[model samples]
Target chain A: MEAFITYTLFAMLVATALAAVQLNRLFAVVMLSGVFSLLSAVLFVVLDAPDVAFTEAAVGAGISTVLMLGTLALTSRTEKSSSRSSAIPLLVVIVTGIVLVYGTLDMPNFGSANTPANTHIAAQFIEKTPHQIDVPNIVTAILASYRGYDTLGEVVVVFTAGIGVLLLIGRLGRRGERQKQIGRGE
Target chain B: MFVVAAIAVIVAMLLVLVRLYAGPTLYDRVLAVNVFGTHTVLLIGVVGFLTGRPDFLDIALLYALINFVGTIAVLKYFRYRAIGDVSASSVKREKAR
Candidate 1:
């Protein structure tokens, strides 16, 4: 039953991704990406990583969608048809995908307890989280305490991204006036 | 029972994806995405119960809130061509004049 649910979710995810790729309308593509994010979030849940799922849903489905729409507003609604041939890119993508699948072929089976990931620091973190962090959620404990520096780096990355977006598209005081001038010129 | 509920939600999600993919208008795609988000929230909750970790409900609740805000943001963007403030654009226009 669990396998059935997982397989269905993954299949839907692929379908949404393919649709997003095929669509030329920017609005529909944005919407499809949002659907893709939501589907992946559900997949994370099925994989027993609710914390990752939560972040994916909030950041992927929510904030990124809004940001993309904002970008869409500044750009054209439909994608321009490129005169360049797609053969090379398609070949590159297929080769990269094949390499990725080949790499994964040697990995342990899903949910195998004896896998290196499950047996490595994961066990130690799970064992010590309660005693050290005293947090009920081990995932949170590890993210916040055990890997505090990594989390801090993640936060800094997000802050830098926000600042970059603000600098780029955010209406600085004079820019708004300039935009109005452009509007008037049009 | 939890598995049954999860399966149902997944099936509904598939239908929503179809609408999101094939919707004739932008509004249909928006609606389909919104409905898909909702289904995701439900699936998270159901899967939490299936796995015997009810704590996952918090994630579901968070997803529901984010989904609502995202839908509102999309609709606002469609209506005003901006998600921030409509009055700001008006003020700019007036200043331009």
Candidate 2:
């Protein structure tokens, strides 16, 4: 049943991605990208990665969609027709997809207890987390304590992104001040 | 059990994606994106139950809050070219900054 859900969600994700590429309206493309993000967050939840799912939903479906629309506000809503042929890009994408699939062929089966990922590191974390942190939730313990540095890094990245957006767009509420500044940035 | 619900949501998402891809106007795409966000919130809640980790409800709640703010920002930016548009009276307040 789990495999069925995973396969079904993955198939829909691919279909959405392909349709996003084929679409010409920039507005639609932005919206489709949000759909793709939301779908991936769902897939992550199905895969038992709620932390990842949370972050994906927050950044991908929420913030990224807003950012894309901000970009559209500055640029043309209609995608410009490219006189160049798309065949090369299409071929490249297909080749990359094939390579990715072939690479996944050798990976351990999902949720197998004997998988290296489950054996080498995860086992230690699971066992030690209870004793070390005494946290009821293992995932939270690992993220907040054992993997503290990595989580901190992610926080810093998010902080920097907010800063970058502010610098680029300034405060939107200061519209009059911005207008006095000549407003050609868009 | 949860698989059935997840499948239904996935199907709905795909149908919304069709509207997003064939959008004749900006509003259509925005609506599609909004619906997709709501579906995602549902998917998270259901998947959390299926996986037996009900604590994941926090994630769904967070998604809902952020999704609302993001959608408002998108619409505001699209309409006024700024998320927090300053009004005539508010313009006087800017001098304090």
Candidate 3:
């Protein structure tokens, strides 16, 4: 049943992604991408990674959709017709996708216990998290304590991105004034 | 039983995605996305029970909150062309005078 759910969700995700790519309306594309993110988040849960799913749900479906819409509001609603040929891009994408699939051929099966990821520090983290961090949730303990610096780096990156966005698009209040001044000078 | 519920939710989500992909109007797409978000929250809860870790409910709750806020932001953007205060433009016009 779990495998069934996983496969179904994966199929739906691919379909939605294809639809998003084929759509020319920017608004529909943004909305379809939101659907894509939601589908992938559910897939994450099925794959037993709720924490990653949480971030994907919040950032992908929530923040990115809004950001894309904001961009659309400032730009064109429909995609412009491009004169450039798509043949090279399609060939490149297919080649890259084939290579990616080939790369995944060597990975261990999903949920395999003896896989390096499950055999390595993951076991130690699971074993020691309770005694060392005294946290009920091992994932949280590992993220907040064991991998403290990594979490801090993630936070710093998010902060920097927020600041950059603000610097670029946070001038709404001043923009009106600037336009008025230009009108007066003219 | 939980698997059954999860499967049902996934089917519903598939239907919602169809609407989201094929909706004739922007509002239809927005509504479809909102419904899809709701289905995700339900699926999360069901899968949490199915997997025997009810703690996933916390993530579902957070998802619900963010989904609501995002839908409102999109609707507001469509209605006013901005997500901030609707009166900001009027205030700017007054200041320009």
Candidate 4:
């Protein structure tokens, strides 16, 4: 029964993602993307990671979809694929997929109890985290304590991306204004 | 069973990638990329379960948050730029008249 539920959730995730891609209208695509996120949140619940599920439900289904819609309204709705060729991006994607597949070939069997991942720092932290951090959730303990620096770095990256976007758009605005003024003077 | 599910998710991810590659507008590409990001979050969670390392859910959560913020920033950029373009074009129209 549990296996059935897990499989169902997984199927939903795939279906929603495919819908996001197959849809032509940008609005529909973004909405389907939210559905995908919700499906993933359910999958996380099935996997016993309530915290992760909560974040996915909130960020993925909630905020991300909203932001993408905002972007859609500001930009063109349908992609103009007729003008350009699809060769370059296709090649890049294929190479990336091939490399990832090759890397996965050497990975331990799925759910194997004795995999190297289970024997390394991950296992040690999972075992000792509750005692050291007094957190019931071992994942939270490791994220907030042992590997906190990585999370900080991730936040910094977000900050950088935000600043980058601001600069890009800011410059575009100034350029547009200058162009307008020149048109008026002429 | 989980393996089959993983395959389905991977196929979906491929479809999203195709959309990203073939997307006609920048907005379409961004939409597909957002979908891709969400799938990645799910993929991480499911793979962690499949690999028997539930702890990796932490990273997935972090990813979900960051992806949200990144999407918002991009959207904000688009909005700001679009308004500027519209005003500039209007000014051009007046000058031409």
By DockQ, who's the top model here? 1
Clashing pairs in 1: none
Per-residue lDDT tens digits of candidate 1, residues A86-162? 99999999999999999999999988999987888888887888888899998788779878999999999999999
Q: For model 3, how does the per-residue alpha-carbon lDDT over A50-107 read when each residue is reduced to its tens digit?
A: 8789889888998899988877766789999899999999999999999999999999
| Runs in model 1 lying further than 4 Å from the true structure | A126-141, A144-149, A171-177, A181-186, B1-3, B88-97
Tell the DockQ for candidate 2.
0.58
Clashes of each: 0, 0, 0, 3
Candidate 2 residue-wise lDDT, A1-186, digit = tens: 667778877887888888887888777777778878888887888787877888888878877887777667656788888899989998998999999999999998888899887778888887788789999998889889988999999999989998987876666425646775575463
True contacts kept of each: 0.91, 0.81, 0.81, 0.00
- What count of clashes does model 3 give? 0
Candidate ranking under TM-score, highest first, comes to 1, 3, 2, 4
Candidate 3 structure quality by residue, lDDT tens digits, B1-97 = 8978987898888888878877889899999999998998898889778878788898889888988999999988877675566666545755686
Q: After superposition, how far is residue B67 of candidate 3 from its true place, in Å?
A: 1.9
Each model's C-alpha lDDT?
Answer: 0.85, 0.78, 0.85, 0.69
> How would you class the docking of model 1?
medium
The candidate with the higher DockQ, 1 or 2, is 1
TM of each candidate vs. truth = 0.85, 0.76, 0.83, 0.54
On the 0 to 100 scale, the lDDT of residue A118 in model 2 is 77
Per-residue error (Å), model 4, residue A15? 3.5
